[model samples]
Target: MHWQRILVGGTKGAGKAIADRFLRGGGTVIITARSAPEEETESHFVRADVSTSEGTTKVIPEMLDLFKGVDIIVHNVGGSSAPSGGFITVTDERWQQAINENLFPAVRLDRGLLPSTIERGSGVIIHVSSIQRTLPLYHSTLAYAAVKAALTNYSKALSNEVSPKEVRVVTVSPGFRETAAATRMFER
Candidate 1:
């Protein structure tokens, strides 16, 4: 499946790995993140804060320009900056941050890109979710888990809506991996 042009939100950790795989398979990979990846990859990095609408707005033109348009989208950006306390300690601000980081990027990107994909009548969307969505660790990742739950449900609904249009939407729920964020969480 050579998608030719692919867009991946969050070009770090698992996102980078996925982009690398696509690049190795001869696909053009464009990756977005607040900062560059730790190391160089075959992917073209688009530095944008995907946690905000402004950032996503910034990305759309660049992405469209990069490859004319994309055929595949991987929504992989997610994390929490809130203090790792129980539910009482998790503030409203933190909850919103989780939604911004984990959920809205996908929503906004789909809103922006899916039109072209639908017009082409062919594309794939992979929403990277968390196992925590079902098996939560409330001590630290409650907000992330809850937002991912919403994302997973939304992805499923999107699959239902878009599959009929010939755009395949899939959600990939991965278990814990030792990314830098996870290392930080463990250190905390």
Candidate 2:
């Protein structure tokens, strides 16, 4: 594989699956989340909420020290925490939280780590957006969808800027999945 070092921003759901695939391919995988996974894994686990500046600050240094730089970075940490009502129910704080969770981490991480990838002149950054960005359930995920739309746009802009430097930026927007977080969202 061209990618020897990989960083996955979340390790509980889709992110875990991505990390597992890379690990099975013999790549060194580093996975980060707010909490540890329920089961042990081969990938290096970094417990940090990348949604917060402090969390990103903690994880970036560790990642740089461990791999010097990574070959691939999967921005996979995102979710909707707003209540199940429409726009009126979502206050400013909730909207901001949604943006913080669904968008800022990737922006921050890319800002912190892209220099290394650009210096190498070869790397890939994948932003895991959501299908909801285009077809959204406004009652439950309005803020999430909005931020994901922003994420996809940011990914495209980042790609245009970095592709010339040989650092590829791509966005993947997947449909619904059966995960603990999804289950909770359903229950809400």
Q: What residue pairs are clashing in model 2?
A: none
lDDT of 2 by residue, 1-188 (tens): 54545554556778778877888888677888888867878888888988899999988898788778787898888898789988889999999999889899999899888888888779999999999989989999899999999999999999999999999999999999999889988887
Global local distance difference test of model 1: 0.84
Model 2: residues with Cα > 4 Å off, grouped in runs: none
**Most TM-score-accurate candidate:** 2
Model 1, runs deviating above 4 Å? none
> lDDT scores for all predictions?
0.84, 0.86
Q: Per-residue CA lDDT of candidate 1, range 53-158, in tens?
A: 9999988888776666688898888887767787988888989999999999999989988888898879989999989899988998889899999999999999
Backbone collisions counted per model: 0, 0
